[model samples]
Target chain A: MKLSLGPLLYFWERDVVQSFYQSISKSPVDIVYLGEAVCSKRRNLKLDDWLIIADMLDAAGKEVVLTSLALFEAESELGLLKRICGNGRYPVEANDMAAVSLLEDQSPFIVGPHINTYNPSTLALLSESGARRWVMPVELGGETLKQLQQARPDNIETEVFVYGRLPLAFSARCYTARAQNLPKDHCQFCCASYPDGLLLKTRDARSFLTLNGIQTQSASIYNLIYQVPELVSLGVDVLRISPQSEGTLETIDAFYHAMHSEVNGNRKPIEDWQIVDYEFCNGYWYGQEGMLWKRTDEYKNLESALNR
Target chain B: MAITPVGMKRITPELVCPAGSLPALKSAVENGADCVYIGFRDGTNARNFPGLNFSTDEARQAVDYAHDANAKLFLALNTYPKPDQWQAGVRAIDLAAQLKVDALIVADPGLMRYASQNYPELRLHLSVQGSATNHLALDYYKRHFNIQRAVLPRVLSLSQVRRVALEAPVEIEVFGFGSLCIMVEGRCALSSYVTGKSPNASGVCSPAEAVRWEKQGDHLCSRLNGVLIDEFSEHEQAGYPTLCKGRYRVNDSVYYALEEPTSLNVLEILPELMQIGVSAIKVEGRQRSPAYVAGVTRTLRSAIDACINNPEEYQVQPSWMRDLDKVAEGQCHTLGAYHRPWQ
Candidate 1:
């Protein structure tokens, strides 16, 4: 299975973002998506900057995709979506039906996770419209993926979220701005401070979620490294790793090593391979609760097969 | 034996009102509401806030009282459940069914399946949390899951509503007042990502505890989870802290990335809605005071009578309908998705 680096969901300095992609272009990740998929107001990097990075990654022998914002409030945003559709250099990931309507028969676009592909018929309709690839939401796993993939149109690429916090929702309301005591129209870009995202806890203080602009995410960094073998068995075309502020490169390298090796040293098993120090949970991928993880001998064998 | 001559009866659309408290329930029934929707105070329901919803004893008594007064009672079991809470939610649904709720408004398919299998006799209405904006999702619920009604999402236009009502077998309950959610309900992930508790899974969104009203020299700041969304001076009106209507700063300027604070005013369009085949008119706020419920229901009930009676003058916004400030969001109102041209 190939690895695809998801777009940067957080706001970083422009130089920081560019440098992050510089390293990504050289990494083992086969496909790299570019653009801001969240709040449209996050403008640390514009479309040109994303295009520059996309060109660099494409030169580095990687496929690049431009993603549209999940929520659009005005005509200007729609105009930009039209412009992105006409960019021609790369495919656009349509997150909303409006974008899908725009891409019908015009180009081979990607049906994004937010596009609501819960069943076979919806998948068939989108694929017939022009979807060459599709990404299952983080909540869906191997079992659900197989169902969608079975009814998938001929040659539809299937990718799944394998790492990083799961994006739960997008809205016009900015929770961070609200937390900062400002309305969404006058928000001061306060979300820029936390490069990763602010942790949200239950009143009892359980770390349960994270806030990034208008988008909400799972507190746990979903890691599916152990399920790579299951992924291979299912013939998933790509594994997506969402961008994180720190240690993402290390995580990428660990995935690379595991993807190419049956065992790390001492035959300790590839499933036992610790990719970064983040807490690992494969429950969603395994059709268990998202918070559950299984580390057994079988899981070890599964990991070994994935890495090899 | 009593035998009566058949009398012509004009069918009045059922007015569904929200009862945040017991007193509100009594006031709603007293003010001629055909039905009332409520929930247990826990996270089992969508309006799962502290000091809101109802206790078990209160819910049972409320049901009895509403039935005694010739009104129906609905229990909202709309929030999505985590794996751990699924059993508890099922228990709650079963209990409500046993209490003889007129119907249960639920969103999750798995939970709906549970209700269908375990308590087949219970009435089920798809909650707005189901986000059945398109017909197919609603058709799935009606044909296979056996939902009797569906509360349509707020993102649809009137023509879309007509199409949906015409196609689906279930009755359609629409929002007539309160906060207008800009995003598609149940399908939204924004609140859960920021606050941990989701409107879908946990039954809360842009929760009040996470909100802060910070006052600067002249402007009052409203923040949710420490993210600044809006600022108002002493001159501007204060609205609730909801994520979608908040503002954001991009580049050097701040803009309204979502929607502005506004109440949904479909009162003027009631005749159009009815003409389009809406089965029921639902007022959205169940969290407001009892007085607000009485006022809204009284005005709307009068308006519905006039519309079905005389259609000409009813086409205009009512002179008394403007008195809806006590129950509106942002102290202002709009036609919402019906007026997407303004959006």
Candidate 2:
């Protein structure tokens, strides 16, 4: 399986974003997704800036894709979407149907995870519209991915989100602004201070969610390094790693090594893996509550014991 | 039901209402609903609550009753079905086709294709679950399946709604009143994150099975799957536990970080909606009772009529607002995204 870097979902300083991509050009990720996929108000990087980074990554032998905004509520956003679709050098990852419609009949595009692709017919229809690859929705489980794999059209690749905080929802109201008692219009770009998003805890002090500008994400890091073998068995073409403020390169390296180990058929023990030190959850892969963590080995051992 | 003449020729906005049961359907039709939308008794629709929705026999009765009163009955096959339950959605579409329901409100593109191909004559209205906030997205469906109408998601402001209505290929529908969804429908997964059930897949949010209530001293606490949603004081009202509307700790403060539990009411902006060429106004409460549906539908029906009769001299009656406030969630209402500052 190939490793791909998802679009940066957080807002950062222009220099920080540029330097991050500069380092990413030398990384092991085979594909790089660039552009703002979260809020349109985040203007630290424009289309021109993304294209310059795309050119650098292209020179570094990396395939680059421009991702559109997940939600568009203004004409300016749609105008930006049109420019991204006509970027002329890279394929656009259509996060919403507006991007899909704009990219249709023009070139092969990617259907981003935000677009609903639960069933086979939706996959087929997107394929018919010249979709080259489709990312699985973050909340869908491995079982659904397996079924979709069986029914996917020819030449359409399947990509699954394998790492980073899962983006759970988007809203018109900005929770980052609301947290500071500010309205969305006059948010003053306060979310810029939170490079990894502000953590929101339940009243009981349990970390429940992370409040990005207009997006809510899982507080737990969704790591599936142990499930790489299962993902390979399911015929997943690419594994997507969402970029974070810190230690994303290390996470990418861990996934790269994990993918190589699975390819060599010499699955190493969990202790030998250079995994990041973070609370991990794979419950969505196991079809349980997304916040719950279930070990694959536990289920395997239970099955073996039952058989014996 | 009368179309007042705007600048040129413009169709009067229809008052589309919701019905969880046959009585609600009848009440909606009798109270001046131009159309009534419902779902099956199973998970084919968004409001998959216990003892709610309609069986086929009841659905047949609903169709007859709505048609007799010159109101259309629509079936909502809105949820995205996974492979395990894909056949259930197809079966629901087949049933809608067989019943000759006036329209089938759909969200899934795959299911939209199925309904469009198998039953070419069946009218299609894109459900709010589809989350088409712009005209380009609406055009995609209109170009592919020839959808007659598309319900705009609640994410768009009034000006954005007008921009879409000006360029959209199909008729437009906007939610006028109901419990508000802070996030875009069909795109949210916060419910599944906590309860393992989602409106997209299971057609329910905060499913009843995952909900637990406990009283601690004088405070009443409501929990969903062992997660404390809120703690209500002795005199405070404890609203239904939805993840978005619940109080949570953001930074150092604990409050309704996403939104407070309040219903969305657009009675104050009926003229603006009609002026934007919106074809329909929807009152959203399929899980509510018949009396709730009747009261909301009656007020909205009169409001729409009054707005049409004299677009230049129309005012939202104080009594209309009072009637709606009686059934509003938390006994409070906001204009939601329609008012730009609410964002």
Candidate 3:
């Protein structure tokens, strides 16, 4: 399975974003998704800036895809979506139906994870509407994906979000600004301070969620590194790794090594698991509570045999 | 209802209300609801709460009662179904079509395709859970499923709503009152992240089973699955522990980081909504009591009538406002995204 880099879901400085992609040019990831998928007010990287980065990544033998915002509220946002769809070079990942509508019958595109493709017929509709690849919604489990694979249209690739904090929701109200006692219009670029999003804890001080501008993400980082074998066996064509503020290159290397190791018949269990600075969760894939981390086989085998 | 004056014309928008049970459906129709939307008890709809919604028998009777009262009945099969549950959604659609309900409010494109292909004559209204905020999104549904109407998500500004209505190929429905969803419906996974259930996958948010309330040092702490959602002081009133309405520490201060516990009341915008060609005004709260549904339906009914009869003299009466406020969440209301400052 090929590894793809998802669009940046957080606001970052233009230079920081530029250097991040500059480092990614030498990474093993095959497809790179560019552009902002969260709040549209984050204009640190305009369409022109994204195109410049796309050219840099393209020259490095990486496929590039532009991503549209998850929530479309203004005419200006829709106008931006039109420009991205008509960019002529890279295929756009349609995050919302508005994007899908604009790209319909034009050329093949990628359906972003935000679009609900829960069943086969929806997948079929999208495939018929010129979608060449579809990212499974993050909330769906492995069993659901397995079932969808039976009826998935031919030549359409299935991608899954295998890493990073799961994007839980998007709203018109900016939670980051609201946390600072400011309205959305007066957010004052407060989200730029949170390179990986602001952590939210319960009254008992248990980490629960992350608040980035308009997007709310899971506090527990989603890691399916241990399940790469199962995902590959289930006919998944692409594994998407969302970008984080730190250790993204290491995270991508870990996943890339796991994919190759499994194929080379010398599978190395993921040890030294401090790849990112968050607790790991794979419950959504296990069809359990999304925050719970079910034990992987390596840990299960190390425990009592009866525990299995 | 339509009112014609000389060369000018105005179509009184439909007063669509929610009914989670047979009693709620009856109360809404009795209280002047032009149309009532309901869900089956089988977890196929967004309001899939335990002990709520209509059984097959209950749904058949609901259709008869609404037809008898000259009020329309719309069945809500709005949630996206997984592969195992896909057949259940199709069965619910078949049952609703067989009962001859006025329309089917749906979100999933697969289900919409199935319903349109199998039951060719049934009317389909795109549910708010469809999250069609722009004209292009609405056109996607209209072109594919031949939907008759589309409920706009609550995320749109008033001018955006007007612009969409002008360019929309289908009739537009806007939320007039209900518990405010800070996030767009069908797209939010906060519930699933915390409690393993979501409106898109399981048709519930902040499910009741995951909720627990405790009194700690004179403050009431509401927890969902051992994660505290909010803590209310002795004098402060506590609303439902929806994650968005919960207090969280942001930038070193605790506050309702997403939204305060409140209901969206658009009675003041009824005239503006009608002028912008809004075909229906929906009163949310299927999980609420029959009395709540009746009060909201009656108040919005009167508000729409006044706005239609005399647009120049239309004023939100204090009595109507008080009646709605009594049933509002957090006992507060806002114009929500209809007003620019709230966004």
Candidate 4:
């Protein structure tokens, strides 16, 4: 299975973003999705700047796809969307219906995970509209993906978000701004301070969510490294690894090695990829609570016996 | 307030209300709702509560009762059903068609396609859960599924709503009053992240089964799937443990880091909504009581009528606001995303 780097969902300094992609250009990921999928006000990277990075990634033997904003409340955002769709070079991953409406009947495009492609009929409808690949919606389980894979169109590719903090929700209200007692219009670019997003914990001190500007993400990173073999067996074409502030390259390396080892018939120890300190969850893949960490069948018996 | 003396004006917007049960449906229609929308008794719609929503028999009676009152009955098949439940959604669409409901409010593109292709005559209204925040998105739904109307999620400002209303190919509906969804509908998975059930797939948010309430001495604690949502002191009235509305510690401070528990009340903006060409005003509560439905419907109905009678001289009455506040989620209201500052 091919590895794709999902779009960066946080706001970062322009230099930080540029250097991050510069390093990503040499990463093991075969496809890269870049652009602001979160807030339009995050203008640290201009359209031209992103185009330059897109060109750089393309030159480095990696296919690049541009992502549109997931939530657009203004007509000004549509102007930017039109430019991205009409870039005439790279494939645009349509995040919202507006982008899909603009990109349809033009060229092959990708339906982003935010577009809510659930069943076969929606997939078929999008496939007819020139969608070449569609990312599975984030919260859906592997069973849903398997069922969709069975009914997937002949020309469509399926991508699953295998690693990252799951983006749980988007709002007009910017939680990052709200956290600082600032209105969204004058948020003061405070989101750049925490490149990984501000952590939100419940009253009882359990880390529950991450406030990334207008997007709310799961505090626990959703890691499906153990499910790579199952995803491959299910015929998923791409595994998307979202970019975090740190250890993204390491995460990519882990997935690359895991996929290769599974092919060699010698599964790697899961402990090898436990480099990140954040809690891991794969419950969404198992059709359970997304925050709950369910061990793989290989270790389930051992863990359950220990619990007993 | 005195009734306006001006002649009845053009395009008095439709007042669409929610009906979770038969009594609520009757209450909505009797209270002067132009259209009453209800979900099926399964995971076919967003409000898939335990006893809420209509069974097939209840739906049939609902259709008759609504039509008898000259109010439209819309069946909400808005949830994005997975492949396993796809057949169930298809059956619900067929059921809506068989009952001769006025329209089918749908969210899933696949289900919309099925409704459009199979039941060509059924009028389709895109649910807010469809998450069409812009006119172009609404146009896509209009072109592909031939949707007659699209409900705008409560994420757009007043100007954005005007732009959409001005340019949208289909009729536009905006929520006027009820519980506020801080996040865009259909796109949100926060509830599912914690509870494994989301509005898109499971047709509920922070489902009640996962909710736990405990009295810890002087404070009442509310938890969703064992995740602490909020804790209320003895003097404070506790709200439902909706994930987004709960207080959380952000940046070393405890507050409503996302949004406070509040209802979105657009009563003050009735004239502006009417002027902006919003075809309908929707009240957002299906899990509420029949009395709440009746009170809210009556309040909004009068508010809309008052605005229509004299768009220039109309004002939001104190009594209407009071009546709506009683049934509101937090007993307080804000213009939500419609007002610029609220965003």
Candidate 5:
């Protein structure tokens, strides 16, 4: 399976983002998705900059895909959609159907996770219309993946969201703007301040969810570091790692080790790869409680006993 | 346009009912529901309350009983799965496929995909929890997943819904009665931020456990996860402490923070919705009792009949529904979202 870097869902200084991707160009990831997947107000890189960066990544021997904004709230957003899909330079990930309809029947594209591609018939329909690969919706597990893969049309690659904070929902109203006490239309890009996102904790401070612009994401970062074998067995062709602000290099390296182990299946756990938080959950990957980490020795030892 | 007995058939608006319990399901079906929708007791469905939804055996039997009486049963697998809940969600789909349900109302695209893959023959209704707010998202689900019916978000006007229905591929279901969700369904994160569970992720919204009502001297203070949303005096009625419905202090005085404590009643607007090609009218009360179920269903069923029997006699008035609030949560009612003046 190939390691694909999903789009950056956060905003940062142009130089900071540039430096981060510059370092990533040297990483082991084979596919890199670029573009702002959140609030369109974050213009860290314009069309020209993104094109130049895409060219740079391609020169570095990586497959580059451009992403469209998740929520298209304005008419100008529609204009941007046409520009992105019509760029005609690289594969586009259709976050919404407007983008899909633009690319469908005309070009080969990757079906983004949020498009709701359920059932073999729908997959077949989109595949016939020229979807080369599809990232399974984020919340789906291995059993469903296996079923979809079995029924998936020929030559369409299956991808899964392997790591990062899960994008749970998007809306017309910006929670980030609301937090800053501004109406969505007149708000002056306040989401730019929070590098990761504005984390809203319960009064109990349980580290609940992250509010980014118009998107609501899971508070716990999803790390599928341990489920490499299961993903491989399910015939997943690409693993999309959604970009994060911190520990990204570590994430790439850990996924490297895990994917290597998955590919070869004859190795101990990667010792050099430091897990920032094993609080690191693979529960969603393993078909367990999403917040539960299964690799904890207590649980692993119990598994060993159950096997015995 | 004039109606006559010469017309081939009079279209009766569908009386869609909720089934939080088996008894409620039977009551709704017996009373007047042409179709009933239920969910598994787990977080697989959006209404994941303690005593609501059905167990596995109960779901199987409920479908059987609904079918025997010539009514359809729609199973709601509406909550997005936590990575761990995926397998269990698919298990629910497999069971539904085996049972041959009339439809599966799905909220999550992932869940929609799982059901579509596992059971190609089963009908698919897009749950409002899918939050397909516009024609684009609506058509995508309709075209790709072959969603046979769509429970639209409570954020559109009757005209916008008409335009969408014209462009959308399947049936359109609108909420005719229930608590008015001011915010878009499936996209709300307010409750989850203040609590560990989110409605989109955990099949709950502003969970009951987080709500606490206290007597603070002369006022009744309702707090949700410790946020003082409302303080009601003895003269006023206290409502459910949903994040959207709570009263909060904007400047100095306390007010209805997000929305006034009013439940949704679109009975007056039912003809307007039906004229706009609304296929099904939903009455939302998954946590309601069987008596309430019987009463609401019977009333809506008769209302649908009344409209068909005489279009000139069809009029929507608040007086049409007198005691619905006595049994309603939050103790008030309005035509939420469907009516623009709700703002």
Candidate 6:
């Protein structure tokens, strides 16, 4: 299985983004998804800047794919999509149907997680339309992925979002701006302050969600590091690690080691890779609440015990 | 209000309303609905609430009753199905076709392909869960599955709705009145992030099983799976525990950072919608009571007729607005994304 770095879903300084990719170029990640997948107003890294980084990553023997925005409401956003699709060099991850419509039959592209490819028929149709690989919708459990893998066409690759905060929803209104009592049109780039995202807490003071402009994300980081062997056995082709503002390289290293150990048949448990101020959740993979972490082995043991 | 010329021709858009049960279907059709949309008592549709949808037998009866009243019956199989549950969705589609409903409102591409392949003559309307906001996305579904109509998500402004309606290859439908969803449909997973179920995956949002209501001091707090969604003071009324409409702490202050628990009312823009060639108007409350369905259907029917018959004098009646507000989410209504100021 190959490790792919998912696109940056947060706003960061241009220099910080450039340096982050510079370090990733030398990392163990085989494929890197670049470009903005959130608000279009996040212009710290323009298309040209992303292309420069893509070239640098390509020179470092890394495959690069560009990602489009998840929610678009303007003609200018569509114009940007056209330019991204017409880049003529790298594969584009179609996050919305508009991106898929633009990239269909033009070149081989990736179906991003937000495109709603949940079953075999959708997979077949997309594969016919020149999709090389399709990311699993984030909300689907592992049982669903297993069934899809069994029925997926041989030509299409399957990628799963295995790390980082799960992007839960997108809206026309910007919550980060709303948090500061600002409208979306004049957001003042407030999202740049919280490089990860503005954490949303419940009235009981429990961390619940992350507000990143128009995108709402999970407060708990989705950690499928322990399920690498299970994913490989299920024929998952790529495991995607979404980039964060900090400690992304360490997260990539942990996943790389886990996958390598599984392949070598000398598996070692991942240790000392926990980032401060982040909670881990693997429940969505187990068909449980997404914010709850359920150990697969423990769950199986409990199930058998209950049967007895 | 401007009055229409006496000799002018007016094209009235179809008034589509939701029906959660046989009685609701009959009430909606009897009241004034030109079409009634429903889902089976299963997870195949987005309104998979318990005790809220029709059984297969009930659906068959609904078809006959709606057809008898010259009302079209649309079966909604709009949720995205996983491979394990794919056959159940297919069975629902077959049942819908066997019942000879007017159309199938669907979201999943896989189900759309299956329906078009097996039931070629059955008309297909893209569900709002399909989230086709632009013409190109509509064209994608039209080219692939030959969809006859597409419902626009509530995220678009009135101008954007007009642009798509003018350019889309298929007929267009817009939300007329109902509970407002702040997030884009189908794409939102906020419910599943806290709970295990989602509208796209499980055909429900903020599942009732996970919801808990408790009184803390003088406030009533609503929690979903132990996560506090909102708290209301004694003077304030409590709404459903949808994650988007919840109050949360974003920075230093606590408020309804995403949206207030209000409903969407578009009666004031009926003229703009009609002028833009919108083919139908949808009322979104299959989980609502039969009385709610009847009242809303009747009010929208009268408003639509008044607009069509006397376009120049198409004033929004205060009574109509008040009737809609009484059944609205927060006892209040906004234009939602249709008005530019809200966005």
Best candidate, lDDT: 4
Per-candidate TM-scores read 0.63, 0.96, 0.96, 0.96, 0.68, 0.95
TM-score of chain B of 5: 0.93
> Candidate 3's residue-wise lDDT over B1-343, tens digit each?
1111211235678899999999999999999999999999977999999899999999999999999999999999999999999999999999999999999999999999999999989999999999889989988988898898999889888888888887777888999999998788889988887788999999999999999999999999998887889998988888889878898766566777678899999988887888887888998988999999988998988888888889989999999999999999988899988887787
Model 4: per-residue Cα lDDT over B91-155, one tens digit each: 99999999999999999999999999999999999999999989889878888988998899999
Question: Which ranges of candidate 3 are over 4 A from the true structure?
Answer: A297-308, B1-10
Tell me which residue pairs clash in candidate 4: none
Task: State interface RMSD in Å for all models.
Answer: 9.1, 0.7, 1.1, 0.7, 6.4, 1.0
Alpha carbon deviation, residue B97, candidate 5 (Å): 11
Report the C-alpha lDDT of model 2 over A1-308, residue by residue, as the tens digit. Answer: 78999999998999999999999988999999999999999897788988998999999999999999999899999999999999888999999999999999899999999999999999999999999999999899988888999999988999999999999999999999989888999999999999999999889898889999999999998878778888989899999999999888888877888788777887544443334346677888888889887757743453455563
Candidate 4 is graded, for docking, as high
lDDT tens digits, residue span A39-123, model 3: 9899998999999999999999999999999999888999999999999999999999999999999978999999999999999
Would you list the C-alpha lDDT of every candidate in the order shown?
A: 0.74, 0.90, 0.90, 0.90, 0.74, 0.90
Model 5 regions lying over 4 Å from their true place: A12-23, A40-49, A69-83, A96-102, A116-129, A142-154, A228-235, A257-279, A295-308, B1-15, B20-125, B129-131, B136-148, B155-163, B179-277, B294-343
Candidate 1 per-residue lDDT over residues B119-203, each given as its tens digit:
8889889998776654545555665458888898786666666666665567778888778886667667656444545676567
What DockQ results do all the predictions give, each relative to the true complex? 0.09, 0.84, 0.73, 0.86, 0.09, 0.69
Q: What is the TM-score of candidate 5?
A: 0.68
Q: In model 6, what is the error at residue A45, expressed in angstroms?
A: 2.4
Error of 2 at A29 (Å): 0.6
Candidate 6 C-alpha lDDT tens digits along A1-308: 89999999999999999999999999999999999998999998889999999999999999999999988777788899999999999999999999889889899999999999888989999999999999998888899999989989999999999999999898888888888878777889999999999999988788889999989999899988778889999999999999988899999998899899877898655545556346778889988889997656733454455563
Worst 10 residues of 1 chain B by lDDT: B1-10
Model 5 residue pairs with clashes: A118-B113, A119-B117, A277-A280, A284-B83, A284-B84, A288-B84, B229-B247, B268-B316
Candidate 3 reaches a DockQ of: 0.73
Q: Please report, as a residue range, the 10-residue window in candidate 4 chain A with the lowest summed lDDT.
A: A299-308
